[model samples]
Target: MRRPLIGIALVAVMGIVVWQWPGSDAVASAGAPRAAIASQPVANHGNWLATPTADGKLTMVAGGQLVIDAELRRLFDFLLTDSAEKPIRQIKDNARKVLAERLAPGAANVAYTLFERYIAYRDALGNVKPAADATPARLADVVGRRNALRRQFFSEEEANGLFGEEERYDRFTLDRMAIEADVSKSAADKRAALEALENALPPALRQARREPVTHLVEADKAAELRAKGASDEDLFRWRSQEFGAAAASRLGELDREQAAWEARLDRFAAERNRIQADASLSAERKQQAILALQNSQFTTQEQLRLDAALALRARQ
Candidate 1:
């Protein structure tokens, strides 16, 4: 099977992105990446969660078709996933490209070049599994053609690009993470999750590198805003409206809350002054009455306060 010459991108399906408001700096930079993490299948149906509404399965049923070992399904899935992820594929690709600047230089890392070339090949042949006859000879021939048309790892630079120590570490980490995450999953689920992960990896890492820089930029902008005496109220209000709505949209939380009661209390106290200019209320006397009422905690006293407030407000 021939691999894809180009990567898969679903962005063409999503029409006209509406930008956030003009001055709302809360928006991710136009260049900022939206990343897709590996999707976990909670599906109990043999690990298939979402079947294509039309096709009725996430991938073609690999059973009785591939004529390969159980582990071969993942190899097939790696080939099947498009250049673009379900979401973060674009950014992830960019990250890969950025990393490729280092990885592609080394011809010594056959794994990196082999993996990359096979990926293109796999993408090209999509959805169609090899007819149980993809024997060693045929597979070797396909891999050879890929090697010929692809990177020969011919130079020091190409070797460097193909294998960097740091790059190797990242690849190992991702490979282990992918394996660990989907070990319990069925073939389809594992492939789907791994594909989601592989497609997202490159750009996600790039954005990770960009994060501290973006944060620094944001901090500088904030200091400038503060110097200009910009109040946090506006920024907070805008972002609170923009971002927190998702967090706030949750319902059924009322069940978790205890009932609340609002209570008011009032009492009349007599005043007697000996040799004073007039019989008047003192702060000390008021404090004593409030303490007594609070200590009593009487509902009738609360009712009395409410009634008195209503009468007083009515007179006003």
Candidate 2:
């Protein structure tokens, strides 16, 4: 199976050959030439992973310093997925070309150099084996070894920019594990310790870490309110109190979108059923009418999930 890296979804690009899951079959083609990989239209080589343009844009900081951050690593991961089957030289070449096209000449040069080190760092990670006993100390040891490898490969500035957020999260996880393992601490003490650990994180990292859990808790509250016939204003007030006005507005927009989608699905389902039940219409005619209705109602992208939506509705 093709494993998605770091929650990044792989979109199937038209005209590019879909990646075959690496297995015993891939070994048979291990010695295949670089040209064997499908050529993309823009990059001209490798399966190009799409990056979210806002966050993943590559640019330099003021004073000509390279902006060595997680986004750069994201870009590297984007290209590296394409390089999964290619030789090192070809992989570097493809990545270099894409970087040159995306970034300024000077930034591209710096990025290519970092890309080389990143590849080496990833190759080195294959040597990091998990310990037999899954203890907090053992996990911390593994993390330390990885950090050491990163420091060896990258400058302090580069390491900080590239892995700072991740390192902070790791420390938080390890400390939490240690607290959980401490038998002397009462439940309240452990909770206080974990709260302190979260509080110690950088503001942005703390919010990023906490938002999903907060969202789930708020979602349950919102559902309860809606069950009691709460108005949009009421929901917005609650959301604003929980996540601020801007987030509340976005959440309201999302709620409207979901409502609109459910309404459309209902319309489509009713029309489809009517067509199916028409005694005068043949099965072929019913299918054609349903297809036309679908085309008229939903965009190409929305149509992709129509079956699943209908199936889910059926279950509900």
lDDT of 2 by residue, 1-316 (tens): 1121112222221111112221101112222221111111111111111112322446677765568776677677767775668888998998899888877788889999999998888877667654334466766776677778889999888988776666666666668778888999999999999888878866655544443246567778999999999999999999889777876887888789999999999999999999999999998999999999999999999999999999999998
lDDT of 1 at 27: 15
Position 93, candidate 1: lDDT: 55
What is the clash count of model 2? 0
* Model 1 TM-score, all chains together: 0.18
Candidate 2 lDDT (Cα, 0 to 1): 0.66
Residue 88, candidate 2: Cα error in Å is 6.2
Give Cα-based local distance difference scores for all models. 0.33, 0.66
Model 2 alpha-carbon miss at residue 246, Å: 3.3
Residues forming the 10-long window of minimal summed lDDT in candidate 2: 38-47
- Clashing residue pairs, backbone N/CA/C < 3 A, model 2: none
